[model samples]
Target: MMKKWLIVIVFSLVALFLAACSDDGDKASGGKSDGDTVNLDFWVFGSTGYQELVDEYMEENPNVKITINEGEMNDMHNNLFTSISAGSGAPDIAQIEVSQVEKFLQAKDQFHNLNDYGAEDVAENFLDWKWAQAQTVDGEFQIGLPTDIGPTTMFYRIDVIEAAGLPTDREELAAEIDTWEAYYEAAKKVKEETGKYMTDTPQLVYNAIRDQQDLQYFNEDDELIMEDTVKEAYDFTTKMIEEDLIGQNELWTPEWGTAMAEGTYATMPGAPGWMVANVKGNAPDASGNWDIASIPEGAGNWGGSFLTVPKESEYPQEAYDFISWLTAPEQQLRSFEIAGLFPSTPDVYENEEFLATTDEYFNGAPTAQIFAEAAKSVKTVYMGVNYAIVDTEISTALVNVAVDGADPQAEWDAAIERITSQLERQ
Candidate 1:
């Protein structure tokens, strides 16, 4: 009787242990077990004001944990490349700049196709062009979700314009400078009257004109095309430089910030929505003196980013869920308010609250409405994998001509040669 009782006790203990093991296995596989947890790591460059949103997300999702790692733009992108090449240590989520997207899409297999996670159902949530940027050429696989878009506009100092004897009203100024030629005339007047440069740099002018086109350095076939349109921009930028209508300050430099604060430049044309925050941050004391107008000859894009999940992510589904939620219309609007990241989600463009928003930093300009309109008007352009490399060479040539008085034609030819060489190597 004692032996039988012991045998029953041992069997019962084994059953309990097996049940506990099964529950643990279920939690490990991301089942709806009460104790299941999903941890995600996010890598981003620059501030997008995601911390607060993540806090709210965590509050609503007690079983999920998220950590954000912020790094410089170039550093972050380089690290992402290294991690992907190493086949480990990649972040669950990464914010890739618009220019870098094409490069990464070349190795699409490294990223998880978000389509597997119901990406198509939410496809309509973002702009068609934006949504397409992260998809395969055949439109089968998708790797990222759209985030912010940089809709180009002219950010100017109202006081400086008034000093130049130009229209101060946004609508009036916009109409007055409707075309690039009209803009150049205004710049001449501004320089003549205020003795301040009308634009930041020759490269900026070139970038604005280049961005206005539906076609850029490359065509849909990923073939290089250096057409007359690009040369026109280059020639026009050199003309501005020869006329001394642009400043010598390089962007992202301390000298540039000082020049902006001191009203050394009257206008910053072809700037994007995010530049509003940069302007305010760099020139805090220049508050209430600035305003925005539409970019000359319609809107162009400057900078934007998308959030992607790598295949190495242990929790791709959870990462996608968080990103999809984070970029939803409501959350995008909130991010805009917090970080001046213009929404890529068109649904927010018509929101009454968004349209009504104004900024005293820009002299009560209806900033949201202006940027929204520009964002909507932006023409989609094809930037191939080597767009950044080619663009860098061209901009470097422009800088050389602007700063060191390099011969324009020679520099242009050299830039082309350098771009050709790089592309050949690639």
Candidate 2:
């Protein structure tokens, strides 16, 4: 009877130990279990060519499999918000746009700090300001790695530029029209000689000028700085309108496409990501005539994205490794090839392979050099939570003043009032 009781107690203890081990295994690490075939779920939006990179990663590491979930930007952002709120159902890694980064940063605990994995050590690989966009308010947390940047450049019709009696050579043009005043003078000549507008709308001109300033619409504390810098940008754009230097077409409209194809305008201020596709889609007929140049005065970033590892990932280290590799200098070059996803990494800027390549659309101009120079010079601007909303409102005010004959000062006042009320309501 003593032997039988001892056996029962020993077996009971063994059973409890086994149950505890099973529970520990259920808690996955970083998105994978140790010594098991690891599967990671990645969320990416648009054709960033990240999915292709993932396939390459998996091919090399057969034990690690990744599933990609692609969604429209808005939908992806909404899903992220939902997942973060629920504290579950998030992907191992996700791509977040610059416009949406601040939105997510509010829920800082929801993401793994990339700084923890030594992201700053690789900071030299990317443009300074572009890399700065991924940090938290205090810069204590690095949440993401920059994927691509939209450094605004002037995409022009070489023929139209030459016909206007302005220098068509990229170097000469950059030197001669290095200032907004010089650019405006050239625009007047283009209108006089070719009767084609210098730009499609005042908003683009506003963007070119606005991006030059160290600040846009708002200061560091989310305060309005309209009377000085903002007003100057607004007035300059209005001057173009009052002087008849722009075509009256709104952006992304059928008329805008028709104007572009027909050479109704001489230049398009393009953000790299949108420009490459826009030219291919809307102005295909002007293939060899198009070329790119640095924006007058200075360069400003218009769009870009970052890749992040969410806190919900069971495998945070693995997630970081994947993003770091995806955005590594070599992979960035590959992405630039697959899509016009411009490299955020400056390491590739001086690479012969990158500089040697020329696009047939830009008349075989060495565009990589022009873009690289612009990307290098971009000023570090702090984007507040109201960046997007304020940008839209100001664009509307530009149209009103430039197109609808609204008085510039009154329009400026109206914009301020509207934005103030909007912020107050929020």
Candidate 3:
């Protein structure tokens, strides 16, 4: 009877230990057991070429599943804000545009600090500037991983420029219009000779020039500082509008597509690598007639995005692991090949495959090499939380001057006043 009781006690103890181990395993996997599936919801705006990657990831890790929600950039951002305010309904992971990231940083508690899941170990994988952009001002918290970068360059129509009696070779044209002043002079010649506007809009010219500055609307300390470059860009754009050297077509409009197809504009400066897709998609008939050159004198970044794990995520570790893998150098290069979204990983910039990339749409221009050099030249600038707000006001003022015939100085003054008032309210 004693031996039988000992055996039974041993069996009971073993069962309890096994049950405890199973519970611990489930907790570690965010309440899912090893054999159970882990599902993640991902939100993003625009085509990031992530669906293919997500499919691959699921195949490799059959225990995990991911669903992606694609929406327009503005609508998705607004929806995210609403979800965050509701304290529920947020996706496990979200993609935030570079300009808008600063705004989200203001509500940092809503995001998981990626450093908690070994993000610091992969910091060297991305460009220094891009990596810094997602971190807190004190560098204590990181909200996301860099996905893509926008390095500006001059995308021009080969035949339109040649028709203006200008050099068509990339190097020759780059040298001829090496300065903004020189660029404006060439614009005049293009208008006078070819009767085509130099660019689609004066606002684009202002954007390119304004972004090139080492300082923008705000400093690292979050102080509003409008540098001389901003005024210069404003004046330059207004001068183009006055001279009738720019087209009235707003970007993304049907008229803008017509203008590009008909060669109404000769060139678009400060265009990012991703613009290659827009040009190809909008003006398929004009293939081989277009080419890319370096932006005048220097380069600037225009657009990019980061992937973040929201604090509401039940599986933060899984979300981090997936994003880290998705944004790795290899995947980023693949994204470039698939979507023309330039990689933020500098290591990918030197990859032989990346270096050899050329576009038949741009007359086989060494598109990759040109953009890589431009990306290297871009300076690190701090975009404050109010950067986008300030930029919108300034852009609105520019339109008032260019379209409504508002006085340049009066509009500038009013914009400054409005930006100050808005910032104070926020």
Pairs clashing within candidate 2: 29-314, 30-314, 30-315, 30-316, 31-314, 31-315
Q: Between candidates 1 and 2, which one is better according to lDDT? A: 1
RMSD of each: 2.9, 2.3, 3.0
lDDT of 2 by residue, 76-169 (tens): 9889889988998999888999988876777779999999887988888888898888886568888899998888788888989999998888
Q: Model 3, which residues run further than 4 Å from truth? A: 1-31
Displacement of the residue 379 alpha carbon in candidate 3, Å: 1.1
What TM-score fits each model?
A: 0.92, 0.92, 0.93
| Error in Å for residue 391 of model 3 | 1.4
Which residue pairs collide in model 3, if any? none
Relative to the true structure, candidate 1 reaches a TM of: 0.92
Error of 3 at 405 (Å): 2.5
* lDDT per residue (tens digit) for residues 251-333 in model 1: 78898888888888777888888888779878999998889988789988888899999878877778889999999999999
| Local distance difference test, candidate 3 | 0.89
